[model samples]
Target chain A: MEPIKNDILDYLKDNSFMDTNIGLEDNDSLTQNGIMDSIGLLELMDYICEKYAIEVPEDMLTPENFDSLQGITNLIVKLVK
Target chain B: MSRIVCKKCVLDSDMPGIDINEESGLCHFCETYVPFSAQEKSDYLEKMEELFREYGGRGNYDVVFALSGGKDSSYTLHKLKNEYPFLKVLAVQFDNGFISDNAVENAKKMCELTGSDYFKLTMENEVLYETFRKAAESRDAFPRLAKYRASDICNTCISIIKQKLIEEAIVQDAPFIMFAFTPGQSPNPIIPLKANFIRWSRSIFEKQLQKIGVEDKDEKFLIKNEVIESMGKEGPRMLHPLCLWDYNEGQILESLVEIGWNPPDLNDSNSTNCTLNSFACQNHLEKYGIHPYAFDIAGIVRSGDMSREEGLEKLHQALSQPLIEEAAKKLNCR
Candidate 1:
């Protein structure tokens, strides 16, 4: 996994009720798999913004940017650059 | 099986996912807990004032307040109006078919005192009853932590409230929507209602309602797709002022009572609005071996907002069996 993806996964594990038994794939939809709910997503967004010191643009708040590890990693990389 | 309660909070070993360290006598949540610092609290209060100033008098109604007619919500409305009289608020109280008559009256009374419009949001009685019943019967429909935050029935109700209020905010062109969530009920004080997030949440909740066997073809429990499309990049923001404010349950009740808010005569100690709450709690306890309010109350205790003894007293307060049986009978799920 990319370092950013690893960090995101670590944060989820630490804070969320993600079932480690079922494990997770990079592309698996977090909301669909019950890894994160709406409130959890808000919390994750806050974490990303604070950790990366990047204010996410409103238009970038798509599932393609947040619903999966790969998507989140890509979004962070795009923002960091 | 032996039961061990947390020394710091009201959580105990009987609750799922609650692990008490025998040596420490503290649950994992309490052990790893961090309270908001004085600086952080001040910052939050400043941010809230900024939000109020920016969104206060922009339109016919600047806010869609989710008033549950509970002590927290009533007090929140009273305080908000007192502090920001410029705000045009439409207080919405959801009538979930099981809400006490007194709750409706209290909601109306608070709105009258606050000089805000009061709107009672009601759905078909049969549909609401079926939804609550399905929520009670459905298992693992929500994630474990979400379940810990509230009973399945309450989670269902709150989701509906969120979706409906978001819709109300968008449709009414309000810049803000407010919910009187206790500090323990949610972590964030402000959540921007981005279009993507709203769409995402709508889809997830639709799936949840479907899982509970509710045919939401009418988008009964969701934001309409057109509303999502119309919102584009962003919509109204959500604020939980209770999370930022100094929270004291005793003071809140006293403040509300001074403003003519009457507490409903209910056996449930945790809630002040819905009569179905006791039934929901009893059902949750029976189903999951957990008192649904344990996590929320525990957070309050951990924050030192409430004494551990008070938290335990609230947690161990006997649920109203008569109310539970009545609700169950009404839902035909007994």
Candidate 2:
């Protein structure tokens, strides 16, 4: 609850890979860094959809929107606004 | 030994942390049921249509088919080429040493018949086989399911396939990677856009080598994906058209056979694409007391695609005592 960005990143890292001891920066690229696999990516997407109640259009699931924590957080902010 | 499974579906108590409520005779996953009609679903179809429109004709190859020469992948190739003729499809296969003779032949026939571009990457799974044997020997956990879907072995194969597909797509500058996973076999809409999937795969392989008292210096083979942050960044998107469509397996099989596929053997294996699946399923069951593919079969039952009896039959086909032993013997782990 402290920072929505951190919350998102933390949840992602923790749930995925089970290798979450390492810290993730806000701008870190989760996909590029291999923090999660494809399954993990979908889980995060589903989580975002469920948590925010915003339906993510498949067209919008591009790397530009989901490649990094900052990019995803921005999308979340825009949607929940 | 008889297994206690969900009365509503196929999930068994063997899966990690799975519990069946005896009173209802349903597992928690089945009990917590909320089904949505097609109308309320997300804009998945509209987006898929848009993608098909945008990229189906835009590139030298718009999509890479993760073709295993099975009915599903073959059907996917057939549908894409015949229904959407403009899209150039690249059929990518990983020859994991044990691909069935029929599959190999049918794939060749498919290419000739369809005139589609084909590329096969061969990786001998000698080391992979060793890891599986070693895991079973050491009593280390073979990868099991958190949510029932692909059995551990199939999931491992899928991860490798996804990594290779993404790598090939990136290199070719292709816009999309296509795979044929029906409702039962798909991952949970999650994909690990492996930083360097080979690295991830190698780590697991290395563990197996260490078990066999062998060391393979195969690091030069690992591929790392480069993401140029400044460019208009787009990676390969997974397109599973089959998951969206309702298909009758028998009819699809008939269509595939007409197109040169051999009718499957009496086994009628769920994982007909890969020969290594039985070994993988055996590993999961031997170590975890659960069928690796139970979740997938159960999901199929839940979807009304297959009757509960049919799901059980598929599970029995792969996880039977004789079949499990046969797979392990082939891997030399038995």
Candidate 3:
């Protein structure tokens, strides 16, 4: 597992409704699985940007870039490069 | 078998994620809570002023205000118009089919008083009524924390309001959409509606509606994908000014009265607009053993705007049975 993905998973556990007991897959839909709502997603975006010190471009705000651990890690990794 | 209530707020051991310490008697939230410092409040106020200064007069309408005809929203609308008289506002009142006649009149009156254009947004009565009915009947239709903010029915209504209001703001090319949510309801003073975030939020609401068994997922209840595509990286920003300023209910009501804003005659202490609120709260409590307003009122008490006793009083206040029955009949839930 990528370190960024681990960080995001930890953040979800700390801040979101993501159940600690449930093992989240890389591609699981955050909203579909009830782990993240609209507000939760916003907070996640703010966290990712602040932690990585990379501003997410508006064009990159798609579900493919943010709806899962894999997608978020990829977006962060690409932006942090 | 015994209930353990928090000493700081109205939350108890009954609610999820609320653990009352044996020694402290404070809930986990209160135990780790930090109030906004004066400096932080000043910064937020300064940021809001800067936002208003930059975007107040550029768009077709400077602000798209959500007017529930409640005291908080009415007072906020009054204050914003007075503070930024140059702003062109389109105040939208989403008629959820359960709004009181008094609420409708109050909405119109506030718009008149504030010199803002009034728009009453409505959908088909049957569809709206069925949506509320489904909201009441569905279990776990929303996330647990979301349920704490409002009942399933209210979550449904408010989500619809947000979706359609964003659509309205986008279609009108408005820069800001204002909600009168109190500090307890939502702590954020401003939420930028980034393009992808808008789509993500709309999709979540769509799933919630589907979970409630609404067969026809109306476009009126969700933002269209094309609307998102047409916009730039960011759309309208959402502003919750009530969180930035002081929130004394007595002072707010007194000020509103001075401005000819009459209070509604409903028996529900927690709501000033919708008659379906009591039924929604009752349904949520029946289904989940939680009062939906407990989280909101608890946040207020935690903020020191209201005391622990006052919070509990508001939490356990007698609901309007007549109003609930009327709503239940309208929705055929009885």
Name the candidate that leads on TM-score.
1
Query: Tens-digit lDDT track for model 2 on A1-81?
Result: 338788786676445423446666767766545465445566677778898999765456656677678888888887788
Candidate 3 residue-wise lDDT, B157-262, digit = tens: 9999999889889988999999998878874777888887787788788889999997544487888777878888778989888887888999999999898888
Worst 10 residues of 2 chain A by lDDT: A12-21
Which residue segments of model 1 deviate by more than 4 Å? B22-24
- Which lDDT tens digits does candidate 2 get at residues B1-334? 3546898777777666567787987877678644434653345556766777876666568877788887888887887677677677788877765577777777767776777788887775676665445544543222222324444455445555665676677677677788887776664322323333333334443443343344546521233324222113445667776765666777788888886788644243765655666666666666556676676677668777778888787777644455456666767965
User: Compared with the true structure, what per-residue lDDT tens digits does model 1 show for residues B192-287?
Assistant: 888877888898898888878887989888998887787757688898888777889998888778778886787779888888989899888888
**How much is the lDDT of residue B118 in candidate 1?**
94
Tell me the TM-score of each prediction against the true structure. Answer: 0.95, 0.73, 0.94
What ranking emerges by lDDT with the best candidate at the front? 3, 1, 2
Better of 1 and 2 by DockQ: 1
- Number of backbone collisions per candidate: 0, 10, 0
Top DockQ prediction, candidate number: 1
What are the interface RMSDs of all the models?
Answer: 1.6, 8.3, 2.1
**What is the per-residue lDDT of model 3 for residues A1-81, given as tens digits with 9 covering 90 to 100?**
488889999888756645677889999988788777787777788778878899988889888988999999999988999
